[model samples]
Target: MAKFEILSLITSLLAIFVSCLALYRSRKTHSELVEFEKVHVKLSRRQIEEYEAKDAARQKTTLGAKLIDSGGIRLQVSNLGEASAKDIWIRIEDPDSYNPLVSGDYKQKIPYPSLNPGEDFTLTAFIPLSVTQQVYPIALRWLNEDGTQGDFRCTVSR
Candidate 1:
């Protein structure tokens, strides 16, 4: 009876030691996983902020037009981005086959070279007096400071 009790005690001790070892390994792995998640979260946040900044910069540019008293119209392009845009060019697309009567060239790309932030460029042209509304498909392209190219397509209504 004494020998049997001693064997049982040894078995219990062995089982307890194995359980403790498994618990220690599990905790260590859990801590490592948490650390990896922290790094992933940091990287994700940085990418999101970069995209937001680019979107904000793109939204800063605007195209507008106004009718003048001399039977002509003035078209204006404004850049409200925080940084300057380089290699700026504009293209007018006639998708609907509606021809516009203008004195200046519309088929060629109008180059502005560099438009600083918060700057405006105005062009004056004689639009047809008969048309009440006109839709112009304007394509604006520019290069950012980081050598990233951006192209925007918008329609101007007058």
Candidate 2:
């Protein structure tokens, strides 16, 4: 072959080889980018979940109630929160539906001054003989240490 033709051929072959190398490098880089994106997405989701958990912990102030049958049915209210609650009050939601009579001194037992975490209070009440409802709704009101009021409504069942 002529010298010029051979050099031309070599040039063409070199161009083809360089293109293949570039293609392979691009594919590898793309695969690595895909893997990095997957890891980033996973980390982002984990961070979001952790932030939500922390937010809930900061916002939580829980008060719950239940009915117990020790000697008779009694309403037990509990402070299952991280802060102290004050001016706690409990009242029947529908007094007409479930007419309840306080067994003891109403003024002394109700509007409890304060309850700390894990503390509870109890009150005895008697349902009217004419009431037929199995469930009684009760409304609870309290003030947090920050002086913010919170309310919770729950059911007591026979």
Candidate 3:
């Protein structure tokens, strides 16, 4: 065979080998990037689910506190939620001044803990006549997480 022909053949073989190596490396890199992207997307989805779950549970509810006229101070508060509340607080305000008559300063986040569909849990906590008479035009305030608030006031005093 001629030297030129041999050199040409060698060059062709070298080119083919280089092309195969490049293709292999490109496929590997592509697969790695895809895996990383999938992981990131899955993680993001999980975080969104957590937030959405919380938000959906808290969606549109007449969250408020109230002082019932059932003799003693009947503080009936509602969370207006299906799922359990993580960190919920209820503050009873004295109408005379914006002072907390009672706060959810207990270890449990929610007073009811769980509020079912059309089912509300009420805690009838009675305060002595001294505390009750001291404050007038009572107000009920509900707080949860951040940026979640609701307020309601009692009817005109007798």
Candidate 4:
């Protein structure tokens, strides 16, 4: 009887340890995401400056994304680029962190094409997520011309 009790105690402790480990891992992952978002935000700002440096040619390029309309789970990204693009590549990430929300061309640039220096463009597509929360991290990577690239980010939900 004493041996049985001891075994039970040991089993309980092991379970507790495993649960603690899982919790620790989850927190670590989420915190890493938060840190990445911060760093990316800074990098995106720097990119804006780089994109504007070409303004000397009287060319002004700007990129922005917003939730324009939602159909239950769908979302529209407005003002992704300025002109009709030959091609565009987009990456959507976890709003709470830097983790990517989807893999591959999450948002097709074909719908938006290329945005000119100041032309406006919009993309209406489904959000590749089931998350119902109203706020999260979003990151985008865009290439306007041949070698001209831009990055934009936002924290939003709808």
Which candidate comes out best when scored by TM-score?
2
Ranking the candidates on TM-score from highest down gives: 2, 1, 3, 4
List the lowest-lDDT window of 10 residues for candidate 4. 96-105
Each candidate: RMSD = 6.1, 4.6, 9.6, 24.7
TM-score of each: 0.53, 0.60, 0.41, 0.40
Best candidate according to lDDT: 2
Candidate 1 Cα misplacement greater than 4 A, ranges: 1-72, 95-109
lDDT of each: 0.68, 0.83, 0.55, 0.57
Write candidate 3's Cα lDDT for 1-158 as tens digits.
Answer: 99999999999999999999999999999999999999999999999999998776565344544556666545555555443332335544444443433344333434344443355444445455455544445444544343365455653231
Tens-place lDDT per residue, model 2, 1-158, is 99999999999999999999999999999999999999999999999999998765544467998888787767888999988788888888996776453746556777888888999988886766687888888899998876678899988887
Worst 10 residues of 1 by lDDT: 61-70
Q: Rank order by lDDT, top first? A: 2, 1, 4, 3
Of the candidates numbered 1 and 3, which has the greater lDDT value? 1
Model 3 pairs whose backbones collide: none
